[model samples]
Target: QITALDSDTNVHVYAASKWKTIELTSQMNVSTKTPYSNGIKFTWQQSYERGNQYCLAISAWRPFTSLCQARAADNYISGSTEATNHRRPAVVLMGCTDHHSYTLPERPHVIVHVAVWTRQGGPPLARAVVRPFKKPRVPRLQPGQLLTLEPSSGGRALARLRLRRGAKRLFVVAVACGANLKLQILSSDGSRVASVAGGQGALHLKLRQNQPSALKMVMTTNPPGAARTLLLAASTSAKGLPLPRLPRNTVVSTIKASCNNVTLQWKSASGNPNYCIMLQEDFNPGGHHIRALAQCDWEDVLQHPVGYLISQCNPGAMKARRQRYLVGHLLPAHAYIATILVQHPITRHVLALKPTYFKTKEDCSL
Candidate 1:
């Protein structure tokens, strides 16, 4: 099952069994001894230009009541990861089952299904492959210990660590260079505990534990075989650690509005050096717009923003003050919401500021 929270904090639950009927642009197969025996790797090369964006979805065939699927994009930047200007091909690795346990019933073979399409609505041009391999030995992680992995082209790595009893929280910090990084944490039963995607970022994971438990960490890089560096560290506490924080007093006020553009101004508190502004049409139910904005995060806002800009907060200046920005090429007389995001100078963590509401002017010439 998949559960998601919208901007209004509405809960959404999705069944895992419905993936069997979804149409796909492409599909492939892989063999495995048992449902939990080996890991399956999928690689695809994008035939389109690097600037174009595409969505990639992967799922395994399940004859029973449910299916396991994972989705990714070529240009996806998680809230925990810093946004980058470079683009890379999409790559992913999947185990036989979603559960962390190896006690599942055995299966002779597994079929893998892949779907690739452009964001603008057509089938994408790409080449893909599917293969199976033995699970590599994972290194045990000691408390507060940091580990680094450098994988060559078309390679993968794993690490194992035990979450001590009475420790109900886990924090993971990952830094990647030269390739897009994907991280997954799985329990001993093969069930996923938590996962995050980014080129570089940190994530906090919470799990209730009554006794000591073991976990497996999986890291993969995009472009299948691109050589990359991944620095991983795990701990239980966040006190005194340099992490991302939301900028305070981030409120946007409209300076000017035209038929197709809007000028906005907002003040930044001290220490906020960079900002990302996103504008999207307001299509939510009436009266819930502000509530939605108040509850949403960077990931939710970036999903379908119509206009986006990243700029220095106060370029060449050392003091905190107001900054002006313009979001152009919008529809006339359309209601929209603008959200501000602040990036930390050291951790590269991105957090959302309070969102502002506005509307474009009606076209006078009509």
Candidate 2:
């Protein structure tokens, strides 16, 4: 008898006689081999883009069941690597005995084959189930926020999910092959709410609820592919909690050079909680000959003093403007310039001020 099995999709078929398996395998073109004692076994794994075809075949066995008696359904291996190729077919074979009586107690001879084919590029896919143990307090989706999927190696058509809370829209996007996005919506009861497919792979879903909305992303490949579901969490109420706090006004108030050490000070503005202070040596007022010297963050400051000091500006050399902050951190025996800057905390944009040059004691020497 002939039979067919889908190893990739976790589908199997078995018949008592050989002819049924041969007929089924012939139509499917499932590459299959038959063993007299063990029957037929099928196995496959791979994903193909549009306009690709895979084939399998098994036709040696005789007919026992009618050729058109096979049933088709969504194999459980949906949303899997084997399903990425889209539409596919599987075939197998079985052994038959002359007398339908007590048949020889031997393994049914059978062959199995499977193949995947596609027409247009497959659609973007996603997981089909999501379960959150802890509900969000006040779930809200924000723009530019990142969404991730767990166990994403199985050819699921989603990488990240972006949200436009005001628009009440969710963008389902692909990570690996993310192109040609479309929008889709589904009901809370896990039913086909709405779907759109096209050259785009993004989806914009309307919010069905006002409160904290929780739902899983259900994924479907083009065809002959698997389906999957993923959990989606749209609550970023406490996000951006760890963002770096920038400095406001970066002013060079004082620059003192004693031996090889240099101390620089600046003023802080409104929103900046911290500051980045860099001291450069070989400083040129407008030239690029200066190299970075001492660098530090406000958190590393010994105290919340109003001034910052950069020691060892030139290692052991005594230079004039040559030892200064890029904004002009320099001190000369008779001429020195200091530059100040003010930065925005959130924007990270820098506002600069002209450098103030001061003349040192005319009699000081290294």
Candidate 3:
């Protein structure tokens, strides 16, 4: 299940049997596991150019403190990690570059580790679900405002949130134990952006916002009895979370050049879900002049990525790739110096290894 939250997105894998998201990772459970899980291969597209590094997590959790506790847990035993009140998937997929393949990890037959590159996002900023014998006035939450909620009739609460710039998706969720409640998302203009009513119960919706927006949450419901304590929370996705970086020493194993075509090969890293290879004739390196184009400007790294030159998935890395980039005929017998950049699929960072220098033969061919 892909829950796109603004520019960020949440990739949730479910067992074929239940077909629902996990509890804590998603809040679809507290502590439960299916008897059997499907093990066929599942494939998903990871486009680094589309800001692949912009995915974060959001959830419907109580107190939001439980999430912190779950993260602070020690590496659980593969068989069953007692990290939280429940069991979690043993293997979580952080990510892999385009060069690497992502394989699900399982604990023998006991459990399947949920694939999580990293659970970086946290819950909402605050919770104001209130329950009081007497009803009181409720006001809409303002942008960038944090209001601590007190118990009152039809208790009122507000949580200010800001979406990341260039965000493409937004996820909103609100849940109250009782019925007859309303959840509304207000935009910066103070107009109602989205609301959850009509017995829809909890508010769970993924919204689309291209630019950064300020939002406030307003929840209003019937006054609760003193005995009943209201509980609810909300959160949004963000970009620039901490993520692993691609390894170094990304040398082009072999560079074979025909009069026209040039084939470059390299090995794939383990944690990388995909790879991107960029090539350019200019961008001189050092020496006399320029040697091989091994590095690019920092700003121009991820800009205008030409995509991976090639991709071949088999048992082996299949590092060897042939590029039929002939300008028509062949055999110029000229020393050509070119610069290349390999992209980290997840982070979109560029790795410029030693430049590859190849020359064409003197002979001519058609």
Off by over 4 Å in 3: 1-248, 282-331
Estimate, for each residue in 207-227, the C-alpha lDDT of model 1 and write its tens digit: 444424788888776655554
Cα displacement (Å) at residue 241, model 1:
5.3
Weakest lDDT window of 10 consecutive positions for candidate 1: 62-71
Each candidate's number of clashing pairs is 9, 59, 29
Local distance difference test scores for all models? 0.52, 0.31, 0.39
State the lDDT at 257 in candidate 2: 50
For candidate 1, the C-alpha RMSD (Å) to the true structure equals 27.0
RMSD of each: 27.0, 20.2, 30.9
Per-residue CA lDDT of candidate 3, range 125-213, in tens?
Answer: 12221111233355433322223344345455555666656657655444343433566778778987777652322334556655346
Q: lDDT score, residue 37, model 1?
A: 42
Top candidate when judged by lDDT against the true structure: 1
- For every model shown, what is its TM-score relative to the native structure? 0.31, 0.22, 0.24
lDDT of candidate 2 over 192-306, digit per residue (tens) = 4456543312222333433224433444333212223222223323223122211223235556654333455544433332234433332343444222211113223323533
Off by over 4 Å in 1: 1-137, 199-212, 240-366
TM-score, candidate 2, is: 0.22
The TM-score that candidate 3 achieves is 0.24
Report how far residue 292 has shifted in candidate 3, in Å. 11
